[model samples]
Target: MNDQHIVKSYDRDLEAIQATILKMGGLVEDAILLGSEALTARDIEAAERVRKGDKAIDALEEQINEEVARTIALRAPVSRDLRILLSVLRLAASLERIGDYAKNMAKRVTVLADTRGIEGADASLRRMAREVQGMLRDTLDAFVRRDAELAREVLARDESVDQMYNALFREILTFMLEDPRTITPAMHLHFIAKNLERMGDLVTNMAEQVIYFVTGEKPQEDRPKGDRTAYMGAP
Candidate 1:
């Protein structure tokens, strides 16, 4: 009713939205950890839990979208406030996609568990997944702290994830060539590696959003990429 009351109401709405974002982020982070654990341990039950947990992440994304829209219509936020809401929307979308990648990784576990395990492949993938999970955590922290430098650090880490995938790609290729029997499992392993690489990229996207939110400008430097599987193909 009064101007003071309106300001307090808007503040409450913004806080609520941020709290939801963190809640959703926590779920995604857990999914990443659990999904990678399932893969490395060859635990089908853990993988199933990751798959079922995705439904909650999806619901949170929808809720964030609705709340953001409602906030915009009711409060008519301006300037930095609007920027934050917009950033939250983008962050939610990125987190949702990361969740999907995690879910996809879990889906492959069933097949991988049934087939013979590729030597060292799950270990490499789990390591990559762990790195991505760390990046995601840092990006969320950056968002909360409004730390552009930390977000940039998260972006820089993406190259390591790509390099890990490249290394695994060559290893799998060699395995396939060395033994015909390994081709099926190697292909599945490659897919999981690709999925983890993608999750890293999505985390980088989230980091970029944090940078933009803090500075109001996207980073000018080109993101370095190390994925080289395409070049290794038969010519």
Candidate 2:
């Protein structure tokens, strides 16, 4: 009876940790969407709100790490339980990075607000951000369901995000080359696009962690990357 009670207690602790992670994921999703919307609308107040909300996301991550550490110390979880806790750390890290990228995107809205608008560039970036946000939503779902197949599906979708980034990169480059006046805003838009692309990559990493947690093996195939703008020193 005592052992059963202990097991149940550990399970409860794990559930709490998972709950915190989901909460953090929710904040990250909001950041991504809100940041993009603010950029598209050129709403400085909305962008500032997105930036401010990042503190909550960061707080949740810190809370999760502390909870995980406590659980590990008290429960001494082994095998699959240990794997789940470790994967939670990785997922939290990825989510935090995605949040930071969203903040970075929001930070640029003010700078671009003053520069001459690049035709359709903001709209294109919003679409790209939307794609990444969708992927992150599905990745979180996969993590909760412990659905490796769903996670793998999310992994496959990242290539589409990369392709979107590639297209945006070329479009922005064309604008920069055609009008010297567009160089400043176009460059900021490109940075925003790159941030979105990196967010996609981070979402994929989270999806991969989900797959690993479920299957006990990482996917053997190389992740398909569609971003081809690296030749011009684009990071």
Candidate 3:
């Protein structure tokens, strides 16, 4: 192939990669929304629909990874662009995990919705669900726009999500204690709350990937082990 033809082919591959990520992002956002709505409205039908589309998101992630591998083998992009491509794979993985989280929420909906004398979840659960979904929306937007500031904001939102999750834990436990009738639904809310907390973690992963794509530096993972104190001041 001539130089011009090779350039066009490479552009097409890159465009395809971008398109795949956006598709996965859109699906993930929708899963979260539908999962939350299903849980809140006690609509098992909606939950099942969300579950059915879950595989499509997984397929997209796999397809993108394959394309990225092929691009590396054929196009020989520069190191910086290569970092971005690999980061896209990481971001895709994160989004898949997010979809799994949503699926988990949906499954919990099925369980709780069918439980004996189980009603729907509470207002706090619904509010947190919406809040987490918004963060996912914003994080994906930052990725598309390549807005570092917005990405940082998304990272910051993880803390708030965590705080809300803790509160949900306490509040739900209290509700269950007050009335044993609330246990089934409360447990369902617990699963959804855990999913939202994990969603925050996944979005933070996406933000880290965004920074990596922009700077070619893989951000350090957050591991809290006595602040590395055992080795600190030892060397």
**Model 2 C-alpha lDDT per residue in residues 1-235, reported as the tens digit of each score:** 5989989999999889989999999999999999999998889999999999999999999999999999999999999999999999999999999999999999998998898888888778888888999999999999988999998898888888888888889888888888899998888899999999999999999998999999999755665566778765532
Candidate 3: list runs displaced more than 4 Å: 1-8, 115-121, 223-235
Candidate 3, run of 10 with poorest lDDT: 226-235
The lDDT values for all models are 0.90, 0.90, 0.78
Screening candidate 3 with a backbone cut-off below 3 angstroms (N, C-alpha, C), the clashing residue pairs are none
- The residue-by-residue lDDT of candidate 1 on 29-80, one tens digit each, is 9999999999888889999999999999999999999999999999998998
**TM-score top scorer:** 2
The segments of candidate 2 whose C-alpha lies over 4 angstroms from its true place after superposition are 232-235
Per-residue error at 176 for model 2, in Å?
0.6
* Models sorted by TM-score, best on top: 2, 1, 3
- RMSD (Å) per prediction: 1.6, 1.9, 6.0
- TM-score of model 2 vs. true structure: 0.96
Query: On residues 128-199, what C-alpha lDDT tens digit does candidate 3 reach at each position?
Result: 667777887787787777777787787777777777777667667777888898887777777778778778
RMSD of 1: 1.6
Q: Cα deviation of 120 in candidate 3 (Å)?
A: 9.8
Per-candidate TM-scores read 0.95, 0.96, 0.86
